[model samples]
Target: MSTKTKVPKQPLSEQLSVGIPDAGMFEDIPKIRRVAGDSAGPRMKGKVVIVTGANSLQGIGRASAHQYAHNGAKAVFICDYSDNHLETHKRELNSLYPDVDIHPRQFDASNEAAVKAVCEEAIQKYGRLDVYFANAGIATGAVFTDIDSAEFMTMMRVNVLSVFLGAKYAAKAMLLTSPSKPHPSGSIIGTASVAGLRSNAGSTPYSASKAAVVSLMQTISYQLAGTGIRANAICPGVIETGMTSLMYEAARARGTEKKIGQLNPLKRGAVADEVARVALFLGSEESSYVNGQAWAVCGGLSAGHPFVPGRLS
Candidate 1:
């Protein structure tokens, strides 16, 4: 059985009423002792990966890129529509994982040509494309009355269309077997949200876009069945990422930080690494049998609404 590493207690002022998986709390590496017939290396060894929406320092895409490189991915292409943080992120990742090839690109993920080009680039350079994480998405809090058609369309284009393009192209790339890749095997991951599963977590357009993502993965997974490729989605709850930084900041300003995720059983908002770890798992061989599923990494919030313990009434 695996054991978790406990963190030392913190002072009251700095104490959190919630908990997160700390540095040593979870094991990301394969077991120290390898089993016979195992790959005999790190979780992502020799894999070529692509992650979209990776510019934000506190975003899941960035964190996932780091996790992939750390886990022995041969190359990780990190991309974002915005270029402001791309170079900086590349530098940081390169510094940390000198052996892993880290490439940063600036492009709109919703653009079919761009998405196709990226997949082709990975194939040309690495001879195989192992994983594609379609994590680029936009969110809004506009109420129904304030919603505009243009804005709503833009949301779908960025969030839903992007994932569609990613899956379409990535699957094509993964199917192309090369000398390095003896089989048609790969993983395609999309970032959905709990908002997609139900209401109250996002605005109309944002939620609709994410819902499309969830459905897209479900259908795509079946389409790729028996191709040695897998398609899946990650529906994250409240996380302290660049997209949700405003909400977190507001709660902190009101000195209600401890109540950030009070509705969830865990009672805490997650960091990017927490969600990124899930992406890493889907991208690796560890999840070889997992396909066509929407995995909710929402601190059990999606299990059901929180209720008073030992008080049925």
Candidate 2:
């Protein structure tokens, strides 16, 4: 067995009661070891948060929603459109973190009225919205010639438009929060793709939409300057999620699943939890200085396609 150190798991109730993860707890978390050693855990601590597109079992939004609750968020509004398991999931989350107030809602995320309503509900319930994770997105699996204007627009609405709406309403709610509150000006996180970062492989419409999402975050961050509210995006590389399940299925059929992320230096793909970890950081106080930045979480794949440097296996 590997001799790696293990941090004793915090009892769910105590984690909920403690509210904030302290700087002293940083050494315990393996994934959150800030290189500077000034890192901490449970940075959220009593904040009311929202995570969109939390419908899928393998999605980043779902992972992030639970992380917020696990870290002692005062409330977590988990949302998606018409998932049969939403209620069951809600019960599970409540049982796991009884101290948290978990609310599950179903609505069309791209719809402006619906987006505004959810933010309004959260503010009314928790008195403020600290984090809004606009992670709902769709992959347009078609080339330019095969895609129509309607399909293109749908992708944009789901991917780019959703972020715009979340930023608008979430910022409004955060600004209303009392300045005396710990995080009066809050964080807004969007799930962008590495395909948006550069001309890598992906659908044409999907690429364009994600590129717009990245640009949207950069532009909005500037718009909210000095307001204490910040906006940022995460550009994730190959990960095994509902969006990319087809790729994994095909590879597994041929027994080539191990080679899914061979192009990256790590030589393996990631899971929903990996990207969710980044979301947790962006949503927490630890990222107070981080704003208007598009971060790449692709295991160095964004650096360049890995090429063998004369050492053939």
Candidate 3:
């Protein structure tokens, strides 16, 4: 007599069945934040926001500007050194959001006088600035050994000095302007980078400059602790923007696309919008209690492998 082993049957949900009231159910997901009763719209209604380096369409600054405007900000001040591009961005934003208020200004953020003048002009126009996003920066791809002294200085001045000037003026402006009766506070955000947290192989100057920005944000946050002006930094990693496009192209030219992407645990880069969302969060009242923090928007890349040897396991 031969005996066969018994086979257990799978559950009804796991088995393919016809017209059996589908196993998976769908449900409405809750919104992250609500601005009104039973409504999920415009968390930052009526707030005034300022975003620097907003001229380029493929930049973090422009992304943040659009996010703020979409989230119900009353007015957005878009500042950049490119007058024509800034005007174009202004036109584009106005066309997209007919009722939104966008103020475009051309000023070199690295220039102390220029930053101060821009702040004064914005205050004159908007009456007060509730949030300031200092998102302007420049990076060079040269290695430390190959970089010239002038290049290093230029990178520092543009990347580091620009943030300093922007924060300095924005903080001063916020201090003078009294907040609304209920919301007695303001926010300031700076753009740092993963390069600031850890050293990049070939971008020493860029890393150093961003590290300085992190320090600046921390210092400003401490100085304004009791003044109701919060300061923070957004450190992005491998974001797919104009800046990262250049890096990606360079990597491709060097035949290292796979290697570069493999450097991050996510196995992919992030879009400018991803980083912009974080900036918007920090700039909005949603993060009223978050201050002096360097929020990493790098898609877990910064949290992954601290060191990777080129030819070792």
Candidate 4:
């Protein structure tokens, strides 16, 4: 069955509308924000970026794609293997931002040939590649004993292998940036999960795959030592994307929607664009020194166990 059949209409336009400036800039300061200005301008202006798993209207990839364009990317390539709304999303972004180029394609990020072709096409069409975000992943819930082997393996390919393949091609492409540059520079990011950082938070296969992605980024960072390409991962908490809509629906149906993220310190889940902003930061020059780490955007869910001081055994 297609995942699209299970998906509901999304608020992508509304999310993007409020998050990134429609035609302005975003400043990166110590929590001190700014409006459009020379000092605080589009972070991705003139850069070519690609975001995989962008078909879902409300997924992190979609939000990142719009944010990238809103910030002035010369070209943004996005794709998804299952999203039925691929063309619709591409057209929407183009219609909203006439100056920014948005190319939406359909392909499986886990396939080697497909991944290579996407990278090649981006370079051929856009002239160069500056950032690659391997954000395609799936989550499944099942007891360890009940999970099938094939399901586990597929999760690994979707989450872990996709990251590897994207990084492999992104690093090679970033090396071709203007030779005059003193050092290599490009970003390779993947979406991990707070579940990957700890146990008992997510199902077996999903957690394993996400954990591998975190490790993959750390190892890739070392592999691309002098290439100027940085590797990192984003571990998000519960966000109501299509991937987790089933979970959200269950909570809503049970009159427990308000408790969805109550386990975290902030006591609220994040929006897709919130995670996209972090992606924007990692891809921009502001994160020049950030690399090889899994940054959690989970409202402090993974900070520590919620042990009350006097209640401890």
Report the number of the highest-TM-score candidate: 1
**RMSD values, in order shown:** 13.4, 11.1, 16.5, 11.5
TM-score of 1: 0.86
Model 2 lDDT per residue over 1-313, tens place? 9785443332121123344354455456634323111355566787899899998888898889888899889999889976776787789899999999988999878889989999999878778898999999989667799888999898999999999999989988886744335334788998888899877557888888888889988988777766667799999999898889999999999999998888888889999999989998998877777989999988888898566657666
lDDT of 1 by residue, 122-238 (tens): 999999999999999989988977988999999999999999999999998998877777667789999999999878888999989988999999988777766767899999999
| C-alpha TM-score for every candidate | 0.86, 0.84, 0.80, 0.84
Model 3 global lDDT (CA atoms, 0 to 1): 0.77
lDDT tens digits by residue: candidate 3, 19-45: 223334347654343222222567668
Q: By lDDT, who's the top model here?
A: 1
Candidate 3: list runs displaced more than 4 Å.
1-39, 178-184, 249-260, 306-313
True lDDT of residue 267, candidate 4: 89
Model 4, stretches more than 4 Å misplaced? 1-39, 179-183, 307-313
In every candidate, how many clashes are there? 0, 1, 0, 1
